[model samples]
Target: MAHSPSRVFAAVSPSAGDVYRDENQSVFNRGRKQTHLSAQSNVRVIEVTGCAEVSSPPDRACVSISVKNSKENVNDVTNSVTRRLEYILQTARQHDVKEENITVTKHLQRDEDLFHMQAEVLVVFLDFEKMQQARTVLIEKLDKSVCVGDPYYSHSAESLSLLRRRVCLEAVDNARLKASEACCILGQALGRPLLVREEESREWSSSQQDTSGSPLTLHPRTDPTLISASSRMFVTFELRPKDNNRRKF
Candidate 1:
């Protein structure tokens, strides 16, 4: 009653062909993986800079002094600015502002024909109660002498300052947010991020700078209000972009 082996069943089975197909598929997958790895760049990576603008009371103030004398008397203007500078020095000393704190930035003529002179002084600490009082007194006294017979007190004073750290910190935070946003956009394009970089330090605006340090290269979108600690401030930072494997190659 048992059937012969040949008559029992005769069905075709894929053996070497199927094995070869599977092996080829595996080889293709391996090749793809290797290609992807080879295409990846090994460029050094750094994080996008983060900046926060914070608000804090300014620690100091700066002011500029201008004096002009006409009637072809350049000497008059020079003498006038000098006298006023000396007076400012005296008043600063009286207010406990160190003598070194008062500096005259320029003592030159504005034009060869017209008698004009410019002077500048930095009020180290306008927040100081004494310095504030001194400022008012010095202004009044200078108005009488430096501004005398100059027609409507031509001399003008302005308040300038460095941005408070709190505000700067806020700016840093804002900058970080911007950097993150940029990264998000870049991530969608370049795949993903692998690194970021940021800087930590006090930066000064052109107006706030003194006779020290390299000048800061300002960013256009810099929050002027935030940068202005007392009156004005400026800062700088750099951004870095990277790629991450987030998309199908």
Candidate 2:
């Protein structure tokens, strides 16, 4: 992380500004139009693989709570779980959870003289703070018959799409930055990128955030509160001699 990219010509290069650029999708700084270059043997080129990763706290979560009870009569068991189910639904409403994001399931069974009934309610939340509050309220209100599962966190569909695209752009910019530094060392001027392609892409999620106050252990173990995306890009750029400044092809 300490290896800073040497800004040889970042001001004039594609890697100068924010990595998440959409105003103009073109990677290059648009001071001049890019011209096609021939693939002749004389044309010198450099190839590099650029990798980038991005992560953000989850924007969505789901909380599930289940209640069950046994009674001498079927109606009594049903009423027991239904009352708690209605309370759960009401709690979800009070917390501003949308109707479409709430789900409820019920089950009833009888054996011998004992009647058993169970009901589960699932609520989806867009705000983490609100989710925590809701979970707390449910635990405080419900009795031993109720079970509340841990909140499941993840990014929304639109958020994941945007994150993937942004990481790809960052990878391209990284490649350009690395190649530019290499050109400076070899005493050559960097030219337009000739080819760019994504070599690989991966995404994964973990269970929970780190509690030890230390960095993540290794690959596949990311922050529990976040979803992440990474991309590796292969790029080929043109190289030019310092003397031929005006000859652009």
Candidate 3:
């Protein structure tokens, strides 16, 4: 691929130092609280949805394992992952997992310091039916191998993305319920939303260190002992503004 100058130059600089302290202080204000009023109008402006959050354990896991070795010994790491990954694959098959459900997305190498090299193996799940059972089998295998370097585990991101959409819908409904109750407390009519916003997050693996040069492509072996499944989610919400102006009692 031809290198693009714009892409290579993409970076955020943090060199600013107190360029507008007085301006910022003048524009920002805090420490003010809304006071409850007793002679409020019969009409109530209630946010149709203030905020809501709910979480469910993830349904699958994304496990990526790597074996690292010295700069001149790339084959050593390759050989290690081969035996281990093969065992993991075999165990998945033994548990009745379909062959097509597992995929090796990437195998690559990046240069490290003077004497070290970094190798990566990317694995992903296409079927979740046998996830739990496969996880048990894989964890047992990993423990026995005592694979060097830390094991990086995560909730299946693709799976969590689907879950997030559903959870968002439920949260919106929950927020509406709260809005209705707020109106009742003020003894005023709830207003329609004038504006809305939403936000969400996930516990991402720390960003990988940058690397340069050609990548190695390794065929993943079927290994039961070096891989597993898991799940995760972050609470999030939608907020809407309301205008209380009319009520019928």
Candidate 4:
């Protein structure tokens, strides 16, 4: 074996021409290690807005009536107002108006030469037909001393509260529907809702406002004291690919 020492360091291994540099960025990613895609956009979202409006007619009316007269003596004036006061109450009860819904106030004073007696009746009516009937009875049976004022119409607290909540929910539903449609057009799937914001909310009567917050034009057949509520909402929704699986890039 010592006869050929030059062959000991011979060209048996690979030369520089035979060796090559690795083209991969990370050499550790080779061999048994598997490559993975990076997690991009953990949360992708789209924002949209929606609007809604609700309306209800006034459910109650307050009718006012006044009785006033002057006589030579305090007893005579008092008697006169008393007779009209009883008539007013009787008329309301005949029309099925509740006792608790009726109020009576009386006043008496001395003028220069006579006693002046005055009384007023306030009644709240839930049924418009009953209110009209009661009004007609008072106007027909009472003397000229009795004066009936116009009815005041309005909404109850409970009704207004329910209306506000309903309008807001409708607005939110509209927002979700709008977002879903947008995702569909964009070739994506709509995911869970991320957030909701009630941008604007307001309520007013037809006697006060319209769509632009101005005076509303009343229809002859519609209620003039109609109540209306409007709601505007903004919502954010997650957007995902129709196929919700990841792919190697």
- The model with the greater lDDT, 3 or 4, is 4
Q: What is the C-alpha local distance difference test score of each model?
A: 0.39, 0.68, 0.38, 0.67
CA RMSD per model (angstroms): 20.8, 10.0, 17.9, 21.4
Off by more than 4 A, model 4: 1-41, 186-189, 208-223, 240-249
Once superposed on the true structure, which residue ranges of model 1 sit more than 4 Å away at CA?
A: 1-56, 110-113, 144-249
When summed lDDT is taken over every stretch of 10 residues in candidate 4, the lowest stretch is 1-10
Model 3 residue 243 lDDT score:
50
Worst 10 residues of 3 by lDDT: 3-12
Candidate 3 displacement at residue 188 in angstroms = 4.0
Give one digit per residue, the lDDT tens place, for model 1 in 168-212.
445444434443444344342222334222333454443223323
Sort by TM-score, best first: what order?
4, 2, 3, 1
- Local error of candidate 3 at residue 87 (angstroms): 7.0
lDDT of 4 at 29: 18
**Which residue runs does candidate 3 get wrong by more than 4 Å?**
1-45, 56-58, 62-90, 101-152, 189-194, 199-249
> Largest TM-score belongs to which candidate?
4
**Measured by TM-score, how close is model 2 to the native structure?**
0.65
Candidate 2 Cα errors over 4 Å, as ranges: 1-38, 41-44, 154-160, 182-191, 202-229, 239-249
In order, how many clashes per candidate? 25, 1, 18, 0
